[model samples]
Target: MNDAEVLMNPNDLVQFLKKNPEYFTKDDILRFCEENHVEMVNFRYAGGDGKLKTLNFAVSSKEQLDTILSEGERVDGSKLFSFIEADSSDLYVIPRYGTAFMDPFAEAKTLNILCSYYDGNGHPLASSPEHILRQAEASFKKHTGMEFKCLGELEYYIISKEETFYHRSNRIGYHESGPFCRFCEMRTEAMLMIARAGGKIKYGHAEAGSFTKDGYYYEQHEIEFLLTSPILAVEQILIAKWILRRLSVKYEVEVSFAPKIAIDRSGSGLHIHLLAEKNGTNVLIKEGKLSDTAKRMIVGILDISDAATGFGNTVPTSYLRLVPNQNAPTYICWGEQNRSVVVRVPLGWVDGVDMAADANFGLKRRSEKATRQTLEFRVADGSACIYEMIACLICGAIHGLGMNGALTKADELYASRNIFNEECTSFLKTLRRLPISCTESADALISKRKLLERDDIFPPGVIDDQAAKLRAYNDSCLSERLRRDETLFTECAEQYLHIN
Candidate 1:
């Protein structure tokens, strides 16, 4: 069967597992592999910097499959980050069967499974980004008896292969279909590929940003995902990125996830919409209004908004996007339908609003009730590690939920003003500004280590290592600017103009 057919009828595998009792056994996997003509399998994992790394092996026989299943592949963990020393750098990769999918971009028939990292002694790697997110997921569920669901609106820019000299106006690319949207067909194919790989894609569209320079025209676009469990969301994000990257190569285009590609242009953002559910009810919405827990979560996020910037906006270029009047958030605040705040509660129909008056009313209400109750975190950019970013957000919410008074104060202070306005600047001055640079954000993260390190969610020393890396990156950028005799803005644009 084709990949789509196989994924569509997942019950075939489910029934096989039910009959076998011991699913993913060497024999079972070999049988399936043979039937599917899977010549190779790749074990994939997230490295320290959240980049996906892989180890591929030919799976021509049952022996190979058995060997792979019984003896997981060893990797040099020290190379990944500060996870291990060279003397004892051994790590293991254990494949997750549920994540296995046919590689749509592979030249030959291949299967890819996302792997979990384990230490030399067979213990879970605490420094692993996936592990950190898993722990956070468990902790959040244990403490609140609720499932955390997340939907991501990932924005990126597609650059043309042929260079052009004409510079287009800024902020004019939103939903501009037809001739200007060169990569729309590729995006549609990517969405289909994502679905075949078990990802839920809500929609894809051109975003509000386009510019031409050095014979290349950069057009921004976004693909949004349906709400799913935290772990699934992370997995889907990785898969989506993989699809985009592979497809870009085929299309002779460059896809950049960088927050700000130009000095004076709209930057890409990864706006996360979060929801919490208890039993069968949406905990984020109570009686058609924001719940106390939801309010606290928002307050908690804003409380450590400066520190949290390190998690979402990791690169030096990320801060360039956060200026006032841009689509990016510049201040630590929340407001309904305000894109200028760190967190935005989009205005939609009330729970019981009439569908006749508004076409979107029923859809909005159904989404709130069944899919999610909304809070859009607008601060995060494309540079973030997906797992780490979500974990930090969850931790911040936990911290915020415990401080009722602080939450109340934050709600009173920020739930109304449009911080982008001149009138609100004075009020914004009272609230903390998100760190303006990578170094400053790293320092904030170091200061708030306690908040993120609670319950061992962050591996010991991982935060320190990440902070040091950020500082080094900042130092390198500074030195490069000085060496080139270029201003910081020009240097930033040069370094990040094509970065993915």
Candidate 2:
């Protein structure tokens, strides 16, 4: 048996290092490696392009393992992100103990941990995504006295060459099982690994996107994570993508989190469900209705959705997924269970109707008071700089909190029914439309960046760099060009199939 497979405690793979869990420390990490005979230490972090990068170390002694965990290592930050200049790009990558997990794909017994970057002066790198998120979180808490929490519903398509039986029809495989959902096993397996690696996982299932194009079968699946702070939420999603990519290689299949992998087909969206917590209670809902805080937050989001596109929808293909009549939103609006709007307030189990009574005839209950009500921001896709995305959101909410007429704005923009429905055409006219192209999105960002810069969370250089990247695509005419040519349209979508 390989050393990686046989551990002193096999359950450690499922558990958090098999000790005082959740609050892992340097000593705890060292102890786990020594006890489990871990041979390699891998430090991973999310790069500027929203991808995970790893630095590996071969640990032979306890001293080396302790030193690695305590002091960490240095790397050229310019390579991971284009923001920093090469002359002064050396930054320290320090392992975050709480993110430690066993690497299932490593041939040797490997311990993997996510790291945060720091400049040579020992300060958090301002350009670092995680650092920016941390600052945003702190600023929001300081002003609102509530912690911003988020959950991610990450969707992606899996492509396989085999034309097997029970092929599902396009856009009809939601929550499917068995033969109908060909990739259920792999999906569950991915969820298991993600959970074991400190991800606050909710569930995994087949999504409503399946297609057979050009002799290759493309099916969609989603892995959603439970609510956590913005920092950990982003890390879990990035780590999940890394695990998916690793498994894809072993399965000899291709995977993509791209917004639009196929023209006129269902596009994958990284829908982010947001909430604010105070004293361990959700403040987004009060007495079964949207709270003032929630309303203000929604208005804030709508106010900045166009400019925020530079952060959420980074790729040119992102706009391709946001057309009207599709599940994606083309206008800025919010409503309860309204898919036509950018923000959807899905059913939140807030009825207090004991759901467990249906499963068990007689069951004891306690004072259950954890609210699942959240505002789902549906615009963000896979091709996003998640840190910047959440930071802008936090800033927007902060600004809305202070705005005198935010509540009125929310009421004015609320859609009782699907705005895209024929009957509501006149009402939809009142709502402002979100940007539809990379060029338009960048233009909005540059024009209205003050919303994101309210708390100095996003440095001007950061926003400018993002805007510059979007403008480089010059996609103002991309939609029209793709609409006219079928081959060019599909080819364009396929190229950006896996920007994550």
Best by lDDT: 2
Residue lDDT tens for model 1, 206-255: 88888776667888889999888777888887788878988999888888
- TM for candidate 2 is 0.95
- With candidate 1 superimposed using the best TM-score fit, by how many Å does residue 253's alpha carbon deviate from the native? 1.0
Q: List the residue pairs that clash in candidate 1.
A: 163-215, 164-215, 164-216
- Candidate No. with top TM-score: 2
Worst 10 residues of 1 by lDDT: 13-22
lDDT of 1: 0.76
Name model 2 segments beyond 4 Å from true.
1-22, 169-171
In candidate 2, clashing pairs total: 0
